[model samples]
Target chain A: MKQYQRSSILVIGGAEDKVHGKEILQSFWHCAGGTSAIIGIIPSASREPTIIGERYFNIFRDMGAKDIRVLDVRDRIHGEDKGYQEYVEECTGIFMTGGDQLRLCGLLADTPLMERIRQRVKLGEVTLAGTSAGAAVMGHHMIAGGSSGESPNRALVDMAMGLGIIPEVIVDQHFHNRNRMARLLSAISSHPERLGIGIDEDTCAVFHHHNEFIEVLGRGTVTIVDAQAMSYTNQGDVSAEAPLALHNLRLHILGHGDRYNIKNHQPIAAVVE
Target chain B: MKQYQRSSILVIGGAEDKVHGKEILQSFWHCAGGTSAIIGIIPSASREPTIIGERYFNIFRDMGAKDIRVLDVRDRIHGEDKGYQEYVEECTGIFMTGGDQLRLCGLLADTPLMERIRQRVKLGEVTLAGTSAGAAVMGHHMIAGGSSGESPNRALVDMAMGLGIIPEVIVDQHFHNRNRMARLLSAISSHPERLGIGIDEDTCAVFHHHNEFIEVLGRGTVTIVDAQAMSYTNQGDVSAEAPLALHNLRLHILGHGDRYNIKNHQPIAAVVE
Candidate 1:
């Protein structure tokens, strides 16, 4: 339970525009201090770990990161390798690719590599960026599984422990494109103490100043579900499989250039010229 | 966030045998210092708060409690009333009735009354007991709502803030009778950091000595879902609404006279004479 004091995180909704311009990836690179950065690509979440690792390696190299290495952690054994630990220790930026979130946790959670990554991020020496499943693992309360298009219902989503880089929030990737509102709403309704963030495709929510405010970037919207002020829900009285009824759920949809204040639970309007 | 250093709590599953033997209620009374105890019945969870309050009032009185008062917190305004605050402050024991957990939270959460109750409990001056919906609100990660019968799935259960008397454990009531194992499993899978306790009907899990160990009483069993050592879960790769696949989920069933150690995540065998 190492508390992150001054870490900067980029949680991208899945399907980031890698082909067109790779702007979200570029933003992550810039935040990592541009050409001076030593980047590490952790592709443990992907089934084809080496392939995805090379994918990110090339991307970061093409963006002028002189030193970029892919740490292919295929299992617990690889996660325990000292060489990978050294890579994590030396890297200024760590990028986690989109794939299976549980794969990421199963391989890296509680391992030495995970510890080093957390330590570096906590000391403000690293900028961690994750997309899709990578993004989902950023929060402690990760939305591991759930369906789209359905209204809020009991047992609509399944959860698993995440990497815990962000403790107070639950992250959902491929949000609007998959119609994940019902599931994310259900998630926050259950755990109102933690903020629910739904990041859409091609978008990224940059948590700056130790996660105080998140700046939204990319083509899609970031939906924030805050149930702190919620008044009522029929969760107990209703039968299993019944549609959920929640009241006073506060939602904020922010797109490119917009910002959201996590502490205040309000949206920050973009400054006008 | 006042943590309870040395508090005693009695979390009962629904349908306790109040008329036949009244063993569970008697246990709660005995733990509250017997005859000299002044118990405050918070019937905010019940729809007919006054009627349900009086029912418990008679029950406690018949159990030979000298002073029993019903704190009718109908709304947030009533929760702020000075008279109610005094009642909560002076009471030696507090009992929350079973009904709608959300109704209880909606009326009392963050109110002056809740603050006083929390303070009293934290100082080890009050014995907090709840049944059914009452039991659900004992933990910070309260299982606000979820469906039964279905296999573990995404968004199967809903959560909200609870009284925080038991911060580390998630309490589920009417465990076996309603078949709530699936939802509780789903809950622990998502938040492995917290322990999930599912209490069966007519049974009560008594957490004494500052929640070091839980003593089981009554007829049914208390199911403990410990996912701390879980090896894997299909939560990330499975589609929404698909049956959840989890491996290495440790479960313990405790009946009368059994004890469970929370810190060690193991059951202590009952001593034989």
Candidate 2:
């Protein structure tokens, strides 16, 4: 029930610019404390955690982060180590890379190390950024796997328990790039209480202000599927593969610099300063 | 909440023998009062309700039933007709033919006629038989549409509201012939409270004695998937297309003359007469 009052959670879609501009990652670094940032890279979701961790470590280090460590946890036991917990506790920024979300939850779900990270992130002590698989795990109801380029249906998207970092929303990364709108819509049909957020590749939905608002950053757009006021859905009675029919579902698209009010479920037109 | 204390609800899988043995239909005829039976054929689910309805009416008539009426209700307004309600109320036997479960529900869901039919069935006033689409709509959570021949996942089934004659179960007809075991499993994943019943072609599952017991009659087997004591399922968090993983799901297969306890969720092996 705790809200992110002072914390900044950057939920990035996959395939972020690691080479050139790094505008999205730069925002994360700035929010994470710039040169004074004590950063921790969590590549547990990746198949090759060492390579992924080192890659992120280099990204932050080259961007002027003085204190950085790669918390390459392959197994759940690694999350129990006191040393990792201490490091997570002292970190000003945490970065989670893309890979298998089930593996991510399997290794870090209930570990004390994850708890410490969540606590620091929640207490406004650290800024947390999760891309792809990491972004997928932000919601309480996570989407582990699904297909794209299909009409929304009960069988189009698969879901599982999420990390609950931002419990109110279901986040899907690489949205437009993978043609995943229908997938997200299907996921929302099952759980209408949760807001559906589809962040495009290279894009980021920056949640701030107690998680009440979202600011779109980087290239591409963010699609929001809100079924809070859904009038009807055939999800409960049909078989999984049947095409789902949902009525009165609200949708919003936010491009770069666009702002949204999560509480009100409304889009705010971009302001030119 | 009304238990079927004395009702005989014949849930038939599609392609029940119309020409040769006609065993399933015979059981329905015998249960309906035989020579004294006043049968009403409801072919509202069929694309050509008149053709389907008349076909069933003729079948029942040829089987020695003295009185038979084809209530070919194609529109929802037809369900509001007092004539239809009166006929439904007077009929000692009701037969629902196969086609589209959604169409059937769309026309009859909350109609006075359907209410009357449901009330009569619940009160043990009528012996009702539904085949294929008819069988599918007998449950509270109906498998309106879905695919077969695949692994069980959230996306394999499409469900909708049914007539709910037997509220505790979900029925899928044409089971083994279409390889729909995965489809039924997917449906059960969404609703663990409902008992899943997959009836094979040419088969009938006859419910009797306060809906507490099910007797499998005819040629094929009835597959039952019980998730009441299911220990673990990734259904809650996975995507729709992702293959589902379920643990501790109880399964039972019953052939001709096999009896099963619906209340206890157990199979009573076929008794040697």
Candidate 3:
């Protein structure tokens, strides 16, 4: 038996070398439930989804994923792939490759692929792993980058729907290097009740169903923006030609090796729920 | 007459103390070219736009806006005041009072009010300014939040439309305190050729004509992320869920009292074309 009753799921932001790939693979392979393989991705939005395609295959191969397939269905309008059934059936674990999250969400929204992934995670028999864009789209809400810090104007800034694997949490990748913290803070400030998670380049944070949190191999820290207790008004519904005002907003930051049990949606002690 | 032509606009972000009743009043009296008035915002998506409403009216009135009027257009659908025409025609400058950006965007997206304002700025007959949410929307692209930096999976997090005043520039207000440098960098990385400008709190960078730039009063520095001459692929368009690899991205930082000119889309010394 594994520590989590449900299938193991590993969510990662991009920069694989920093994401502790080797450590995660070892742990998933050791799961006694016998894992299979399923790969989810926003394939069409990326210019090189095939870049690490072979590495993922190799990892899953070592994890006993005899059959591995990458779904490149950019849209339902394009239809599904051929071996999706076998991949889903034998899927002891599902992996999501990181790329362009917008591209991923574009494909998964109201599509059969997203529906299937939701069902698998619900069944808790499969493991889920995603990196970079893959990890971003897994959550209910995700960060869409906006204008430069030079201008405070918030136009053309929109949010795309996601797989909803994790609700009330918005995620971003390439954090510090990209300096996306302000964008994330503005994001959570728009919705004070939500929590924003930012995994640094090449880092991974795993949340288990049994209430355990583990920091995979990576050099960067995870930045969490929790506006649960704060109050803000983004004027999101206001006209774009006007100024927006916000008041009384607060945030909390979390790091790797930290545990935030989702059951209650608050920062908790570093212990299994 | 104004120095810069249309097709490009400068957007200002917000801060609380910057709106000291006496100072804003002076700005209008000394710097403003025409009659000024204050606009009040009502409830929309977030907090009340009232705080800023009072602040603007008080400041404008104190600054010799004897013809000043508070167009309390809180609810666009239901509460747009009727006395806008006189003010619009008579005023030399337009100040977008602070409120929830969503509400402002909603009320002004297709209304005659936005049309007039756009026309005024296009003709260089009036200056447009905003704070906070008002500032976020003045870009060719807006962040619309939803960007979770935790992972690159959700890169296309979410986006909303803007006034389309400023081209190729995405603005962020209240920068350093919130750490949005990364988000801006991520945004710039998406379009390596584009420029990302992050304005610190209480700071304003005014873009005059097509080539002139000036920094305004503020405590923090302005950040710019320029990604030209960089190599990145498999981003926003990947074949699968692979970690998008970005190579050779460069960043620039600008602070107060610093000015630069954009000649042929490149930042250089302010000069006459």
Candidates 1 onward: DockQ, in order: 0.01, 0.02, 0.04
Top TM-score prediction, candidate number: 2
Q: How accurate is candidate 2 locally (lDDT)?
A: 0.81
| Model 2 lDDT tens row, A152-196 | 566778899999999999998887556566678789989999999
User: Which is the winner by TM-score between candidate 1 and candidate 2?
Assistant: 2
Predicted candidate 1, C-alpha RMSD: 16.8
Per-prediction TM-score, please? 0.50, 0.51, 0.49
- Determine the TM-score of chain B of model 2: 0.96
Fnat measured on candidate 1? 0.00
Local distance difference test scores for all models: 0.77, 0.81, 0.53
lDDT (Cα, tens digit) per residue for candidate 1, span A33-85:
78877898989899998888888888888889969988888879887898888
lDDT by residue (B1-273, candidate 3, tens digit) is 123322224355456354444332244333444244332222232355466556566666655554555455545543334467556666555666555566667766656666666777667665566566666667667655533333332252344666666656677666654555545544554555555666766656566663245433344445555445444333565422223333333333343344544443333322223
**lDDT of model 2 at position B250:** 57
Error of 3 at B267 (Å): 38
Per-residue lDDT of model 3, residues A4-37, tens digit only:
3345566676765622455545554444243533
Q: What is the TM-score of chain B alone in each candidate?
A: 0.94, 0.96, 0.77
TM-score of chain A, every prediction, order shown:
0.94, 0.96, 0.77
Clashes of 1: 16
Interface RMSD of each: 17.7, 18.0, 13.3
For candidate 2, the docking band is: incorrect
Best by DockQ: 3
